[model samples]
Target: MDPERFQKNAMYVETPEVFDAEKNFDDDGRIKRTGTLTTASAHIITAVIGSGVLSLAWAIAQLGWVAGPAVLLAFSFITYFTSTLLADCYRTPDPVHGKRNYTYSDAVESVLGGNKVKLCGLAQYINLVGVTIGYTITASISMVAVKKSDCFHKHGHQAKCSTSNNPYMILFACMQIVLCQIPNFSKLWWLSILAAVMSFAYSTIGLGLSIAKIAEGAPVRTTLTGVQVGVDVSASDKVWRTFQAIGNIAFAYAYSNVLIEIQDTLKSSPPENKVMKKSSLIGILTTTLFYVLCGCLGYAAFGNDAPGNFLTGFGFYEPFWLIDIANICIAVHLVGAYQVFCQPIFGFVEKWSKEKWSNSEFINAEHEVKLPLCGIYSVNFFRLVWRTAYVIVTAVLAMLFPFFNDFLGLIGSVSFWPLTVYFPIEMYIKQSNMKKFSFTWTWLKILIWVCLIVSLIAAAGSIQGLVQDLRKYKPFQAEQ
Candidate 1:
């Protein structure tokens, strides 16, 4: 195929109209007014920092403290380099029109055309949905766990439970889907900012309380290796444990699509490439520092046996009032994440069924108004039903297999690795036409292979964990 024709075809590959405002350039080669750099960057950061940070210590504990930071840094380097390459491919000129524009799948199709691209695209979509669901379910459980703990229930009477069927979690997920349906990307940008701020604040406060507890001379346990204060797993299991750590790191760094979406959200000349590059750097650095601090402080304060959710775990030892406040904050923050995850899926479904259902007069016309200013929209009854079905499916899965962390790990291991590592380099080489791989490219390929291997190992471990939990699974139980 002629390179130009190939590029044009790739450019038009599944480019959704909803995203056109952000991705389409005007006569002057600038994106139409959609959102600002700050707004776009905030969304990127929010998308990246989900439940993975909370569980860093658990994974790192298996690898020991000395190895934890090193692993994190390595993952960060790999993620940043590969992400940059993908960004470069995205900026390549369109083959047909001689214009430079790209979509997430465009990059993939450029390298591995035909069935490979389709398979990868399908996997990417599934992974995105899976992670979103994973985050939603985990966040819901965390919210309810916090609420029922001594923290949120200080008053004798519980807040009237919103929805009884699947607990308030279903209700929470529904609310998020509704919010995401709002059509205004700009408005959604502000919401993303709020969510990102709340996440950082909640995590910071929780970490602070844990640190204060440690400073007050709380009981501290040294590692089995006799390290005064650090993570330690048995030496015999070091390699396997390191593999686990790599999986955790990959999970933490697996938001490249989110970053790409954010980049596409910008409305500037050539979309201000620096904005994304800088934002990603800031996001990764902030996230890594936060995780390391939280992990170290949490371990110092409560040791390895600390509650899986550090906030709830710390609440058991702190003042009842502090715990209550923390619970409320955590719940709110989690709700925000649920909203972010649900929005894209809602958009995808809405677009998928638009032709059949959107023009039907019987359908509520008010639902079709693309309210870009507010980033909110109404969905027809069918869309609502579809979303509800998704919620039900996810909730049933969560209930059937209530091993939260392991389930999350499994989702992360299976989906995140292919989406993040395997696909990016392939896209880059094919799209950019790098006939001879540079040293940097060669290193990245090696790193991606390593990540792929680690993902498989982690998937196996997570499956094992899930099986063990299922053998002893029980319905929701309040933390003792």
Candidate 2:
């Protein structure tokens, strides 16, 4: 599609009336703006950094020290560029255009065509749902870890609590139901800030603890070869593990799904592109530094034996308070991170509900929900019900498939290309109308091909590994 047509269709993608200055203003007539540079950074970081980073040691173990950092840095650059590309494509040529692309799916529809919207929507749902499930798993497992450490260190005995993580997952999913009640994306900035801080806190503690272990003469393994530190695996298994690591790394860097939404939160006069580029830089840089520390130090401390999760490898010798604090931070951050990514999904579903149930009692004249529970307050009935259901579904999935790192690897593989790489590059190429065989076009094509190959290999490897493991432990089997 041409750029002009893309601009016109944006009105159909996002509501035009809500952009009005008067409607967006407060009671005192002060203009209400959602975010600044800092909050944008926080939201982006919260979206980008989650339990995926915890698997970096396993990722590094897959690719080894040398290739691990190399691939990590490579994907980091690729994701950063794609993120900025999305930001650059976020607007229209004419100021008179009634709408801006406010979501990734909107951008996809704008640039590609209305026909591609469903395709984009599918990829988005898969990515968002997968990430949410990953978060639920991480949060529940983190809570369990915290409880275990508390029981062991404080009581001098292991906790006899149910080994299954399902209860904790349910509890935290209930907490998400309450948090998800905050209907506005504008209000989630504060939560994002807290989540960002929590993510950093846990990562920093993990790094420090790893360093302390190294200082205490803990055995350290150093190698550039692909090797399992603590576990024995066949060469074929190691090969699949290395491929899955690509997915893990890709997953760690997958935030393009929410990039446009984060950009929409910014209140800068210079347009969101400038702020988005800066925030993306800040968020990626901070997260990358933490990932390096956590991955390398965790590996240095535990060698080939580093657990899939950096914090999960901690033992009784480690400070109980620190472990408790770190795990708490992880759980809290995942809670907020879940919302950050899920907001766009919520928006999409709510819009669809409005179209499908135009005359339903659940909705009011202003498109708000008519529920008695939150009736006095403006709630989207579809949102309350659907978002809650989404959380529950993810929580159930987390309980069913508790393989944290493997699940993340599978998701990262499945969604990375379409969400992170393909849509961004294709949108840029189409929107810019870049000449084929030109320097930019040629390199973008090359990058797209590379992403396709990597995504296929990673997806295949992850699915194989998951299927093999699932055969050993059938669904719903309680943890021993």
Candidate 3:
């Protein structure tokens, strides 16, 4: 998009749509909301079921049949329950007929004010940045998978189809740099819907392949306790992997960071909280079911040796076309997702720069440039330089550490507790005026502490895993 349209279509991915007077304003004097339960649920599922799903099979493999499903269920319930509280916080002082909180940080500022607002902003921006990096890594993996699939199909099953991920990572980063020029690359509302569809496509394809593998006669070994310590892994590695698995699950359900953003899109007539609660339930259930099936079936097929990324990690070698299609879907999804996730970071930094150097022509000036296809768009020197630099940093990081499972787990563990748990719990209690020391309040406190501990342990595990991976591979030299 050119500068004119970029400024016109968006300041962020959730670009405002100008509606006529006939459209209901939802009593907030803002543009009319068209979001219904279906759209809301779609958004939730899209945000929740990202590349994190790629790790679930490995995550489940870390914690066997008994613990894996149980963990997923527990997370589903916790996420849903906390989400209802958060949905209510979308409107301050009242769940209905109250002041609107347009963003998560807005809700935090309105209900639980003070330094927590800064905390919320920090966590959100960091998570968004981390998400973009993760996407960079994930997209590269999928592209590499497409290539590897071809190599395996052309060669033989036993042939070494090994390769590095740096080229693909650079290619993906270059694509993102181009896409980033179009400020509203994702257009959140529509991308959410598209993401949900794409996620379903690839997830179903993966699940189908796993099921097909399991049906092939030979028995695969599985144990109630997952990967054994002595036989499969060292005891220390087991402990760390178990924690890392928890992080992976947390990442899969890490949608709370954007819950208020989705909730803000809902029509207020049905009570946004009511619709949001229902949507959260539906989304989590659907996502969890998909997750359970994928993780369980993938584990059933490969057992102890389940790959961190089943598609790209060389779990299946045949049916090259199907594999290529599934991976292509993932690549497309990540391209959109990366833009959506990174938009906030872009907005934040640009806003800060404009404010800090308000007098600089280089940072403030815009020149109109016409493109044949996208039409005339304004080009800002600062924006071009900053965005390009940002993409470079993320790409360099992805190249330096292409450890998929560990990197994803670290991102999840870092953002899960503060952004997802602590903020929502605090805002809910404060907004509802729930009495201190009450049973519910006490339980919420316990939930906060528990989740915080989990985040810490998960972070440790992920860091350890990254360290171990680094010993095996050099920076920018990551290989399958």
Candidate 1 has a TM-score of: 0.79
Each candidate's number of clashing pairs is 12, 2, 4
**Comparison by TM-score, 1 against 2, better one:** 2
Tens digits of per-residue lDDT for model 3, 1-480: 233433432233222345344452345444456788988887788778886676688888899999999999888888888898899998878888789987788888998789989988988987887788888888888888898899889887777777788888888899888878765322355766777888899899999999899889558778898999899999998999999899889888888887887787777778999999999999999999999999899889899899887887778877899989888888878876776667666766777788899788888776767666655566778888899999999999887767654676787888889887898888888887889999999999999999899889989988988888778865655364
lDDT of 1 by residue, 1-480 (tens): 233332222111222244443245444443344656677667766776765566666555555566666777777777776666656554555422333443456556655668776776576677666665666666666566555554335543344432122465566666665654444344466677877887687677777787788878967663532222334444534555455556666677777755555565665544546666777777777877787887666656666554556654443434556655655665566566555555555555555466566455433233333455533334456555666677667666655544565666666777666677777777766666666668866876787787877789878766666677788765665333
Off by over 4 Å in 3: 1-34, 181-186, 267-270, 350-385
The lDDT values for all models are 0.60, 0.77, 0.80
TM-score of 3: 0.88
| True-structure lDDT of candidate 3 | 0.80
**TM-score (C-alpha, index-matched) for candidate 2:** 0.88
